[model samples]
Target: MLKKITLIFISLAIILTSLEAGTSKRKGTAGAEELRIPVGSRGVALGGGVVAEANGVDALFWNPAGASFVNKSAEAMFSHVSFIADLKVNYLAVIANFGGVGVFGLSLKSLDFGQIPLTTVDAPDGTGETFSPNYLTAALSYSRRMTDRIYVGANFKLISERILRESAVGFAVDIGLQYRLESGLRFGAVMKNVGGNMRFDGPDLEWGVVIPGSEPGAPVRSLRVPLQEFELPAAFELGFAYNLKVGEAHSLTLAGSFQNNNFTLDEYKGGLEYSFNNMLFLRLGYSYVNEADYIFNSPSFGVGLNIPLGGTLEASVEYTYRKVKFFNNNQFLTVRVAM
Candidate 1:
């Protein structure tokens, strides 16, 4: 436990140094690509409830430290998301117990852009070819309980981005802590997407430029293109959840989280969920984030079903729908199995 704390502090110190140096420049604008990726997931299932009610491998994505409470011998989950336009995202994760001492997990996420039209200065109009941009990340994580009520986790991630023939790759790390106060109350915090800047390297780097009018062409020279590399969208999250039991057949959960955005300001997310006899659940959630001149207000709804598979094995399916402005509503589905 002390070793984990030391590593967390070291990582934070590096992050602070990088932020102080890079943010001083005050760049021109933030890209749309940065705004599009890392869209929050699984929050729709939280439904304003506290952390003790949170369970399964999905918790690793939301709060890695929560994995310490997994009672199942092994767990696996898969989620597919249909995002704005034609973009799609898929996530897979698995975790297991190690002799009741700790839990270790692996997670992978992929974002795919179908095809985009390619254009050139010569063609101006269109090149009649399409380019696809792909983003992928893989993470390995470990979580351990420090006490009966406190837990901690850390993750190491490798990230990559590819567009057409150009690609950039980098690595990042995440740390998290969760505290369970009671059977139905929980608090959690996590720092995510912290790592080194990525640089683009590919065939595109082979292009050359001619200096403007240098003594009537003093031997055409090759010029190295400047690559604009920036920090990942790192952020911190604090959340609380509470569960209320009403009789023996029904329960209500409420959850809320505050996100401190690194590029922009902070955002708030809240949700509510109702479960019936531990067999079915219905959830609704809302989120608020500010853009330059507008607000990206999204509301989501979800449903979950739990099925018994004998010998303590359990299976469940979950679906969530979210409405986005200026685009078709998004949909996500996940399947989970635990023993």
Candidate 2:
């Protein structure tokens, strides 16, 4: 256990140094900002200090390793986030364990921009047409226990974004590890959104070109503008947690996490949770943003209910309220089923 703990710290130190070096000159270079939003109500309530304690289908958003130990056989979850600008995000994930071998999970996150009036240079505001923008990310994940106290996992994601006639498609991956001690202490680390550049190409960038006197009405050819590529907003995080248990009825947990972002400033998080009989839970958390680039979410609070059903099934429902900068507050709802 001592050796494993030491290794986890050493790995974190290395990653921190690497992240500092990689983000030193790439300040504002990343795109696809929607991918940075945290999913799952429990995670948001903990201010994203979920790397170590992520469980069930919720782990699909944070650390895939936790999914390996999720439930007894199968788990499914759905999440809804009401964000700023009347935007909403929806997530769904399912995980199934394969005996003592491993666990496989699948999830999707989707964003919709509702409807916007379509206007052109000729028609400024009365186009009478509307279009909705779409953004989606689909992932496949797998996790396994490497040792009695160590777990590892990976996730591969496909991202697609479209607006009118323009679209961008890209891919990314996540790698994570989790370590648990006999003393109820946990440690976790992960690297998220590691991918290459994404460039958009569509008919919107193509323009018809015509000579000054070429047939006086017909266009001669078309000119296309090249789109520049942008890097992904990769991030690295380290998390730690410990809990105090009173017999079998009441428990309290405290967690802390550090995030290193390539496209923005680093962040720190602290969270606390109290559960009664593992059925009712109350959570609170705070996030400290570096403010080097911009401000981020501030504080969050949540409540959760876990109920056992007949026929070896259990259900959990969670709700969270997060305070965002300029956006007031955002609400999240999540539901999970395990069997």
Give each prediction's root-mean-square deviation over alpha carbons: 4.8, 2.2
Provide TM-scores for the models: 0.84, 0.93
Q: Which candidate is the best by TM-score?
A: 2
Stretches > 4 Å off in candidate 2: 20-28, 212-219, 292-295
Clashes of each: 11, 0
Residue-wise lDDT of candidate 2 within 1-339, one digit each (tens)? Answer: 768678777977796877753434666677788888888988889888978888667888888877775547999999998888889899999988996789999999998678989999999975999999889999999999777788888899999988888999999999888887778799888889999889888999988789677676685698899989988998888898897897889999888888888877777887899999999999998888755434455889999999899887999999999987776478999999999
Per-residue lDDT of 238 in model 2: 88
Write one digit per residue (lDDT tens) for candidate 1, span 1-339: 546544754664465445422231323233223322432245554432223334547766766788778788889888888887777988889999884579999988888788888999898888999888888888898888888777888778878788878888888777887766666777666776777777777887676666786777577677666788866767666677787899999998888877665666556778888999988989888876555432347678889888989998998888888777888777888888899
Candidate 2, after superposition: displacement of residue 117 in Å? Answer: 1.8
Q: What would the C-alpha RMSD of candidate 1 be, to one decimal place?
A: 4.8
On a 0 to 100 scale, what is the lDDT of residue 161 in model 2?
87
Best by lDDT: 2
In angstroms, give how far residue 164 of model 1 lies from its true place: 2.3
